[model samples]
Target: MRVDDFDFELPPERIALRPASPRDAARMLVADTRGLRDRVVRELPEILRAGDCLVFNDTRVIPARLEGRRGDAAISATLHKREGPRRWRAFIRNARRLRDGDTIAFGGEVQAVAADRAADGSFALDFAGDEPVEILLERAGSMPLPPYIASRRPTDARDARDYQTMFAREAGAVAAPTAALHFTPELMAELDAAGIAHETLTLHVGAGTFLPVKAEDTDDHVMHAEWGRIDAATADRLNAVRRDGGRVIAVGTTSLRLIESAAGADDVIRPFEGDTDIFITPGYRFRGVDGLMTNFHLPRSTLFMLVSALMGLERMQAVYAHAIAGDYRFYSYGDASLLLPA
Candidate 1:
């Protein structure tokens, strides 16, 4: 399908700048082959059945945005994907000012020298000094907020806690697994009481997730690789649930992607630990997830395409239009949707 096939009119006001207070208070739009239903995120437990396995991506968002100076010019760097220790692929402001071999000092203590420019204008950076990059980033980096949030303010103390999910454990993701953000401890306990099981898989969200689809046709787009891991224990648990005829509900697109990437064509999931660049567009066959709970995505984005693959383009468009007409929040820190394919 064409990239334009996924396009929709999203009002600027609809883009959520702040998350809903209490998180679970965010609105939810449930879509299935039957029709659409508007509900609150807190109503998820009642919507799902017992014996269902909810798979979550436990990837933690790193404070990866950093401000530094290349000589006298101020540069803002957002660590996209990690390449090696002290090395990263980053999106920088004023790329023309910096070139290969130019050292950019981060917070006047640690420095990273530009190595090269990737085709997409992202920079390959290698840090200076003996200190590990992780250590330096921990000290100097700030939360990498999405660009739609026009507030140029620094990530405050509240963002440190609010931008992440309750189950975030593993590090490396630049973006949060947003669908998991609505889940609170109370909700988890409720699900547990209802006999619903939850398992975790990690997919360090790459900056590529936010990148727009530049291709004219969806099929021409190549997804960016992100490291992910699903341990044997979680695999065993998921398999057990599947064997018992339980539905596997993915909490977010990241978890769904990772599971589908690791699953065979026959729909059996396996233990996997590696990088994946799996792109799911409309017409792609799904192998793993039976249902999805996820945040509303941007227009013409790969994530929207993935959801379209789950349902259909026409149906997704209708749902999105309904969301817009109903004044539902959009994007990260926005509302969510629970999708069950027919």
Candidate 2:
């Protein structure tokens, strides 16, 4: 299939720029083999069965966006992936003006030397610091919001808290596992009362998640790798649920990808920790997850393709159209959806 096959018309106003005030008050569009149902995020516990297991990505989003000056030229940078304690792959704005050996100063507290350029136009920068790069980023970097949100100025304090998930624990992801954003403490209690068990995994979302597919043919598109891990305990719990004839509900695409990557041919999930470049599109057979809770995705994006893989392409198209017609918010900060396989 071609990348254009996933394309759709999305109105500019439908793109959500902010999260719902109460978080759980966001709308949810439920899609299954039968049809679509309009609902709210708070209705999750009532919608799911007692034996269903909810899997979530515990990876935390870091302040990865930075503003710096490269040899007197102002530039914007977003750290994509960490290579070492001080080395990282970063997308630098005005990268064309930067060259190897050029030094960039960030917030006047840290300086990084441009080492090399990757084929995708990303730069490898080596920070001049004995402290870990993560620490430096926490102090100098800002939240890396999606490009669709046009900031009138620079990132403010509100974005620092709003863009992050309430349940964030382990630190690594550059982007939040958006589906988890709808969850709240009260909603979690409701799930517990409803007998739905919960487990956590880790998938450090990378900057590549936001990259557009430039290939015409979907098969020719190369997916950018992201680090992920499924621990022994989580693996055992998921397998137990499957053996008990319970549903494995992945909280987001990140969790779904990690679990699917760890699934063996024997139909059991195994402990895994490594880089994954799994590109899920329509016609891909799901191996681990029985259901998915995810947010509305961008038109023609890989995330939309992944959701289409779970639900049929035609069904997803109809669901998206309904969402648009109903004036439901879209994207990371928008509403969510609960999808069951046909």
TM-score of each: 0.96, 0.97
lDDT of 1 by residue, 185-248 (tens): 9889888988889999999998889888989997789888999998888887887888898899
Which lDDT values do the candidates have, in the order given?
0.88, 0.89
State residue 132's C-alpha deviation in candidate 2, in Å: 2.3
Model 2: weakest 10-residue lDDT segment is: 147-156
Clashes per candidate, residues 3 or more apart or on different chains: 0, 0
How well is each residue in 13-79 modelled by candidate 2, as lDDT tens digits? Answer: 8988889979999999998866889999999899998889999999898988889997678988898
Which sections of candidate 1 miss by over 4 Å? 150-154
Candidate 2: global Cα-lDDT? 0.89
State the lDDT at 128 in candidate 1. 84
